[model samples]
Target: MNLKFTPLACLLAPLLTACGAGESDETPIAIPAYTLTVNLPQTGTLCVDSNQNDSCDAGELEVSGPAGARQLQSQAPGLLTSPLLFIPGDPAALILMHPAARQDGQHLTPSLLSSLLQSRIAEGTPPHQALSELLAALAPLQPNQELASLHRLQEFNLALGELIMAVLTQNGAVPAPPAASSQTRVWPGLFILLPELSRHFANGGDLLDLQARLEAILLQQQPRALVTASGVSTYSDGTDYLLTDEPADHPGQDASLKQQPLRYRKLDSQGQPLPDNASQWDCVEDLNTGLIWEKKLDDASSPRDLHRVFAWEFGPYRPTQDELDYACPNSEAICTTQQYRQWLNQQQLCGIGHWRLPHAQELMSLQHYGSLHQQGGQTATLDVRYFPDLGAGANGFDGYYWSQTLTPSRRLESVPLAVITPIFWGSDAGTDYPTAVQTPSDVNALQLRLVGEVTR
Candidate 1:
């Protein structure tokens, strides 16, 4: 998706020579030529108005579908550059654009198109000035301000584009755009749910009215665990998560899902809950499940270091000698899962004395499948905001945390518990995103995240 840009200064130059009032000039005015080369992820048709006419005539140059750079020339005389119309088949139906960026050979994505439209430009504005305004408008939309992956952002653009295209082609009318919300992170939700909502109402409702109705519906509903949404809003067979209400009204909620994204509350070292927006915390409470989870630290010397690994066994389980050596080094505390649970209880983590290893299903509850879709693959499967330092650790451990659910060992007489591992490397699209399998009880290379029942 490379887009080659030329100096907009020359394109913005006046197309006519100054002449005296009432002076008749018969000379034909020469139109300045402008070249644009667009690189696409896949072969797509591109059209630019090569003539002063507002339409792409048959005689005008059009680039054929090819998954690479496609160049076109435009000589339209105007302050506003002709819209670069593209038809990228499938996922991307139609991408309308103008020279809203000044970079040379930059990859073109729906995100780029989104930023351009965010400028809310007035008609007849010069290309260079529009580019400047676009950048300024895009400053607050960065990932830090509005959490979104590149893939999700592109998906959003495509979804919105197709919806608009369908309305114009099928309904023969263009609905007015919805008013922008004060929240900067609403685009993902808008992109994921707005289309379906429009279709749900037969595409006749005003976008603003629909948005208000949907918001009211969401406000009245509570977050349900089984009905929890993964934030995926597209291509679900008869089951769309976006339409469901999962209690997403709280501030600082993770922007990962469109419906009811995961909600978590942080806790201080003394087991006291902290503010929702607190940047530092020692524990996390899943608002939906009412379970508090241990927060691992990045420091190697800390007992809760994310890199720490342990061995497990059933019926009077104990840590392996290597684990004891690494974990308890020069300390009198025993270094086993049972001992760790007892230690946390003694400390009353989050003011709870029942800290224990989570069951397989409880651990699975933390898995967010939308991560695979939003991030594509080979990324952390949990919300880093609540569970940072997840995924692979030192020496390439698969981040399989030991769970309490036991499975009979085939060869060994002792039963080994199942360990759940979130695929951090890659995914078969998401079919195998949740990897839970039985492992040898004596295996000394596994991680652990303790969880406790929410009694308070």
Candidate 2:
């Protein structure tokens, strides 16, 4: 919602922009006229959309974190140097450059934090359970007590996270704890530190040292599923499938958003009444969004081919040992991600094989929270009639599905590219809904459901 700009030399973050023209001829050296944009997870578009079209249009960058999407763009700034845009007033800006950029990894903005936090809450994920998952994501940076200074700062920042979440809760509606647990718990210093942290994050501080500290301490909250802005791209296995997250606009107040609808259809045409027999393999269509989904998952009884998964570098690089072996027999001329597109153009399943992966938001739309016991309803984890058998863990055919959408951050050769994977169930419980993760790209562990747009 706010904007600031600095030289690219300081913070080498990603760029997202739209510009009219450059400086007049009087200027000898062309300086980048920076336009910094922050995508408010408050809307889920990750700030990439210059027009707020509910989609990432050209020139808009997607950022992750509880801070929403933060983007810096220039019309003529050459590749050599780009300015770093910071919303001093937005706490999410601190993380966008901090731990993720500091560790030379990825940073989840504050908007993303709210999305993860609120999504879990809305879907009935226990607060502690959701918090634990985020903490686990941060566990990789484990230093819970190593630095007294960092410990103190993290606690202060975490309280700020709570404060921001309160403000983000749909129309600022903070839920009261159940009567049974409300009396036993206490939120210490939560009120006292809110104003201080909010001010510190907003001002972005003049003390360079303070900026560094702000970045470091936020690691304490250590959230996961931190959303990121990604551009459109399709993946090709044997076939090209467009990928995206679940895109159904939820009606209730969620932390990641104020009042944006999924902007897409919630149910497919055939979803209302599943076939009584097992023969309904026809892809179903969501009239509103034009996205068609596979009726069922790949057969669990059949052996899986993990090598089928590939990163931009190509060749299912991160598969399980079993998958690695399976990928070995006569495997040459391995199809890189680029080559996969050619495959997709040729793929035609259900009389429509040119499928693509869905974005994280687009794909997430499939979850039927009503199916979860926590949601107090029973409709099946998803539109069971449409997406029957979206399994979980190492067992069933259902599990994490692949999305072709790429992150706003660059790939670090030292480590795999971080990406969001869609999951349907957590434990063995039949009632669990779905959730997502911002983890390294891996495929041997899960399968994918194909989705695409069909025109009559």
Candidate 3:
């Protein structure tokens, strides 16, 4: 992005040289007034090859012409012109300006020109041919405004050329005259998918048009799907939960699949429901035909220190009633009940059991959309209809949930090979929100979410 210019005085020094001709009276020769037109690629570097390796191996040459104009020559190809004037066929010259090397051993090439063009098109320039016509009108010599102006124009052309080349190459639509050979090879169509070119795709032309083309290509060459499984139920337990038999035929015997009615009560310090609310707890049904969940408060002094516990007697696992309570504590003093409940369902807690803390990796897995920032914070919304029990009120909480796994700086002495834990944000959380957990110590506490897989 940096541009440097040489001063006009330095540019004029060589042109002012004393003319030496035959000692005798000989007529002075006039230089032909031929215009030099340099065609530059849209986005590549330019340089002169002192060694003639067909590569821009040498440093950029400082070029000065008629008038007090000077320019730093770039590896990128572009036209330079002398001030219009009558002169001997041969004129004295000096290196007044040169292109700065941005990196070591970097050179210019036709491909670089193509890349530059692609970038310009992505930036909203019209078709390549139209842009080329416009660029052709630029004069070789920039007025004395500054050398930077001239260099910038050159760089612009380089960028534009690169873009044109990229699009043409990607679609296999480039002209065939430029055939691949040992010294120069045509780039593969797939090169358009590179990260560098992706910027072009994201910003080039109409979004709808781009999306259609990309989707068509992707569908034609479907990528392999990646499937993953986690949770303790998937590990080798005493029994296979997936194969467990249930009472599906007999209504009365189907208690194994029936859902237990949740009990609500107002309690005092002694753990007894208030006198008026006692009936609320008494009405709770055992619902034993299906799995059973017991909601209880962990002993205040227990090191586990959780507010609520949900104990699942059967099925994969269930969030401890304590966990739910922690999420929706009865009092604001205990925790933000409203926020907690919203997070629970948003993170998919209704179907799975044993809502223990999620591991760090499990938390990160929720980010199926890949790097958040790179996508400009745009992500698809999640479907809430699947988990009707989560209820309609559980919305708008775009925060990170914690995992059962702890990300320890050092391995735990008790478990040497434990996997590191990370927090994951639900798709509903939105990419703009930060995904971090808060722990009791200097570290942060992590929230755990529950999930179960179903094959359809």
Candidate 4:
């Protein structure tokens, strides 16, 4: 059977729309309620006779409960609260209940819980309370292997918190509660505490210290039950939990290194450097490098500084002259642009896995403090000059670079221009600017920069 899961965003979209208007105020709106019911079909009789006689019975017979054979009857609709249910010989079902229905003696559904989570987070509900309730809901679902599941729950909680914080911060509000101490109260009720703990630390709290405490507790004693990261003062198990100090390394570093050198080299397959026509350099080269190089220069000229020259001269690395043959195959080559694009569409990269042009938001996320500039020829608020390797070779010096991601508002069917700010190696600041290149066709190029996070 195919399992279906709804994105948390979609499930909460309605609630989000409703609360969006009143979000400016500190007060949370009262949650609305609704009721939901589920009904199961009756089992056929032939199956019951076979169970009773231990043989293939052709005629129908009444099947009973654990005690004895009895008549089977259809069951009335029953209130459902859990997001998942496993009924013997029945397909699982999900029921969604609203707050108003719950108040009228109805139980909450998993979807309802998800909705509440989104709503409360939007309303800037205190993290402690939000986390507590989340934990209470998840506690009953704990699996036999507690540690791994606990870690996953923690990660999920952290991701949710981060998303909420980002939304709140974008809307010009404080993401966290005023009372820092109140965080302690939030942990006991939560099913997953690690993510919340991580969020607390990420938002400027002592998370490493807390992690150490948790490690110590886990090592000393193995607790039969999962404990929230927040209230990890003692362990139920006699063994102490200790956190391993080794940091998790990223797999992207190798890919980044492999691609970095390509930024500097010139010449197509024949060992011929790029022609000086400058005007012809627009979008004719390899989609990824060509786009990068095109965005780096206004019109090719002498290096304004080391930065421009470096970025311009360094990339499109060549392994052998033959390797360049397929670099940017156009109609003139055996593999046309359409063929290359189709091939690219088949490949996947980054955590998103599928490599495609990025949307405008995904592209802009690379922007750092280095991309800022000042008005009227004065130094910009942020300077890219601080970065060390931005424009060092063939790559252009200082200009906006485009990302593959398109803008959010653009229709998925209609490809839009996408770009990012150039990295200024001269200043040591690695900043990316958000920008896009307009395209007549819906077709867009796919370019990706590899980045990874180190989690302990």
Best by lDDT: 1
Clashes of each: 6, 59, 71, 83
Error of 4 at 111 (Å): 2.9
Q: What is the C-alpha local distance difference test score of each model? A: 0.49, 0.37, 0.28, 0.29
Q: Of 2 and 3, which scores higher on lDDT?
A: 2
The local lDDT score (0 to 100) that residue 409 gets in candidate 2 is: 34
For model 4, the run of ten residues with the poorest summed lDDT: 309-318
Which sections of candidate 4 miss by over 4 Å? 1-327, 330-408, 412-440
lDDT by residue (238-280, candidate 1, tens digit) is 3443433334443233333456666788888777778878988
Worst 10 residues of 3 by lDDT: 383-392
- Compose the digit string of candidate 3's lDDT tens values, residues 209-326: 3434443433322121112211111111234334234433422321243423222233332223345434222111111111111222234542122233221111122334444344
Root-mean-square deviation per candidate: 23.5, 24.2, 27.2, 25.5
Off by over 4 Å in 2: 1-279, 297-347, 373-380, 392-398, 407-414, 428-443
**In TM-score terms, which candidate is top?**
1
lDDT of 2 at 140: 30
Candidate 3 positional error at 199, Å? 60
Error of 2 at 177 (Å): 40
Task: Report model 3's TM-score to 2 decimal places.
Answer: 0.19
Model 1: what TM-score? 0.39
